[model samples]
Target: MPASIIEVPVVDPPLAAIGTSDGDEAARIQARLIELGFWVSGADGDYGLTTRQAVMAFQKYMGFNDPDGKVDEPTAAALTNMDLRPVSRANSGTLVEIDKGKQLLYFVIDGKTEWVLNASTGNGQSYTEPDQNTPGEIISGVSLTPSGLHNVNRERPEGWWEGDLGEIYRPKYFVGGVAVHGSNSIPNYPASHGCVRVSVPAMDWIWESGIMPMDSPVWVHDGA
Candidate 1:
């Protein structure tokens, strides 16, 4: 070794991205995430993979853009003081309220949020599906989840229920070819063909619990 040569070690920067993953701050954040309905099954103050995923889900539903799952100052503040809520003009009854703007699904029974789940709705894009009006042909329509009052007309307890555009799990059809179902991929934005996409576990719960039964009212709207 040369006496004149000085070897300096490189230092890494702190993980100061967003949403604290560990520490008291992270624990508080996790508690808030659970309160705000972001599903933190393992919220124990330790910022691990589960906490990160829960934070990501919160960011997605809250309409914040932190793809890295770090809660920035603004995001943390917003999480603490979030005011975005699903609004239903309906007087009172058992119904499922879906907010496409916020990508959230609220299982409301008699005017209470029984279960809150991260959801995705229509992406307002172009899509093609088999035409029921014509034989051996397909039809094109805008990929959209219509915002209106509907009834739970049908349901499919089977998994991976096939659709012309894609597949859904344990779908409960509300309108014509549109349902609030389960999907493995529920992003932070609207990405469904024309249905509401919830978590697979959530879908199973909906079915097993029979929350939204047949003929139950379903209200789909957004104030954003």
Candidate 2:
């Protein structure tokens, strides 16, 4: 048997339907874009300019004849092949909680502590520039490790805090900009710009243990 070559037929953009109106449809589109390596602001149901732009970019990458910002039949067919489900614990191992306040990374299995390590988080108490009066604060809300259940959304070979730090090779976990990654130097307390800092050994352990599977659940408590 030979692999079938998918021939994308020419089709006009469905103007009758400008964009997705359903929340689930938007989520699917957003997930498809993300899987195709396009960063999306949010998966809200509104198919605004950003989503359209992302769609065009995806089409261009696929070598389409016209990378128009419209979801044509070809685009729809390509998207249908993607797995856009949100990350879930059911597909991964136990939850691993990193307590920024306590400076500890706890690996919990079946509601029991399996391993622990000294970690560091965004020093919500430093200034990036000495002349500036405002202290360097981690972006609030989404950037801040919310005190609730979330998953290890994605990982990147390169760190997202590109401009902040000088050029350096490092892997970052995209659980927000905060990641469980290695640091050349670890300060006594919270020091990262916003990410969760782990020792080289600790990072290797987590990666090898498969604790933080894609979309693995994470909980950040305020120690209340």
In model 1, which regions exceed 4 Å deviation? Answer: 1-30, 40-57, 60-70, 80-91, 129-136
lDDT of all predictions, in order shown?
Answer: 0.69, 0.52
Q: Which prediction has the highest lDDT against the true structure?
A: 1
Residue 171, candidate 1: Cα error in Å is 0.4
RMSD after CA superposition, every candidate:
13.5, 16.4
**Which candidate should be chosen as best, given TM-score against the real structure?**
1
Q: Which ten residues in a row have the lowest lDDT in candidate 2?
A: 1-10
List, residue by residue over 77-196, the lDDT tens digit for candidate 1.
666666433233443567888877667776766654544567778999997777544568887888799999999998888888557666679888899999998888877778888899
lDDT of 2 by residue, 105-221 (tens): 566655544444445566664443322223463323323444567677767544333423322224445555566676654444567666666555445545665666777667666
lDDT of 1 at 65: 59
Local distance difference test, candidate 1: 0.69
Candidate 2: give the clashing pairs.
none
